[model samples]
Target: MRALRTGPLLAATVATIGVFLSLTGCSVAGDDRPVVMVSTNILGDVVGELVGDEAEVVTLMKPNADPHSFEISAQEGARLRSADLVVSNGLRLEEGLQQHLDAASAENVPSFVAGDAIEVLDYSEGDAAGNPDSHFWTDPARMIAVVDALEPVLAGLDGADSTVISERTADYRAQLETLDDEMSTAFAAIPDERRALVTNHHVFGYLADRFDFAVVGAVIPGGTTLAAPSASDLSDLVDAVDSSGVRTIFAESSSPDRLVQALASEADISVDVVQLYTESLSDADGGAPDYLTMMRVNAERIATGLST
Candidate 1:
């Protein structure tokens, strides 16, 4: 089986940093306001929008980092344990940080999982078939559900202003609704035959479900980027690509696109690779810095990629 590998040197470096932070007793900067430690940058952005100035939101994952494999510094782990409220994209999405999340839970930190707030979809194919998908943020309606569930929790935080949270919640929810409408409009123009998705992994199942697009297949054979595709897996995907006539395959910003490019090149039919902000938010200068903007950009790209 061909695997997507992380270098041992990088892993060792991260481990060394983690050990140093733990020994130094270093923690994230804090203030009198309640602290909200979030697992992923995508949820971090949304929580920041909802909480505004009510709480100090600290996101562990950096911009353009992979949630499935990104490790937190021990100092950040300390902050996570001490936070008044913890928010995470659950459904086993934070594969590398599950231990820290569990430790925080054991410490009795109040937590809200966005996955719990939505109608979950299971992986429909590959080794992860029937596993709950953690990529629900692809659908704006599901995100609105998360907001609906999270508002009361944030309002109830000891240091947060319930009135302010309620106001922000309503405003953010309206924005999500608008995003849903705009995405619908954009995707409606795509011809029915062209409304199909082939991504680096099964990151777009929720999107396919929400927008009536068929998921042709993935370059990787599972839901998580950590999984590898065997020779047969890649051959099968190439065959599916040839049969489906899907010209555009999406590469996630959080993952390297070499494998996706390879798949495109190996396909019997000519295919183009398009990058999408699937699992993480990018830096300020990057195109997909926020959740709403990311979704809008992806919608436009998908529509354009498929329409042509």
Candidate 2:
């Protein structure tokens, strides 16, 4: 069973590292908007609010792309090289793109690590790699840090538009406050005993802490999906679910849900697999189109799902 888990993740890691690195360059020829590239779709959404058609914010990773395993193209390198500013979640979330970010910095491209605004969960990716958990946006209060960090960076970009950036950021920050308030109210509806979460990976430590749910366990058994679970790990998780009385194992839409479904069969327990946005945001029409709506949708699902 250990081999069942480890084999695929290892293969995924190798396959990922094998891809041609995304391109980098210094020219945005034939481009009209001020070039800005955001590492994740989640950050891209927030950036869009501050800039609001004033700039073309490049979202490098698409919706549902696993931050750990996303591939990049040479066009992306050109975008990075030409970007006036680069916004990233940082904390090693971009496994393949980290060095590219460093390159941009060395070239004196203005960049900001969005995660710097929040308290981060640090973890070793495995024995060989050291990486932080890098999922701080799960907690909206901590996410204020992302907005705070964006202000100075945006201001630095627009001396003429400092007032504009400040006003936009201030407005967006208030909206975030509202979103956090909504999440708190929604989470407050659930009972204490039923408010336990078992997810694909350790993505929600901050969310669990903020909204009063206990992170009973994770499917990966480690900090990341990059790490595979042993048979023992699966067995331990099964035991945790059974003992904790959590009727659900939340899965992300990005990855295969078969493993969790299979684990449920083996454990002889009935469980509902609830889907949630963990790593990416939906397109404009989906339940979690942007960060605020994503959290709102998740809070509703979590609160209602657990309280049942």
Which candidate should be chosen as best, given TM-score against the real structure? 1
Off by over 4 Å in 1: 1-30
Q: Kindly list the per-residue Cα lDDT of model 1 for residues 1-308, writing each as its tens digit.
A: 12325577678889999998876664543446788999999999999999999998999999999999999889888888988999999999999999999999999999999999999999989999999999999999899999999999999988789999999999999999999999999999999999989998999988889899999999897989999999999999999998888999999998888988989888856788999999999999999999999999999999999999
* lDDT scores of the candidates, listed in order: 0.92, 0.79
- In model 1, residue pairs whose N, Cα or C atoms come closer than 3 Å (at least 3 residues apart or on different chains), thus clashing, are none
TM-score of each model, in listed order: 0.90, 0.84
lDDT of 2 by residue, 33-52 (tens): 56789998889899888877
Best by lDDT: 1
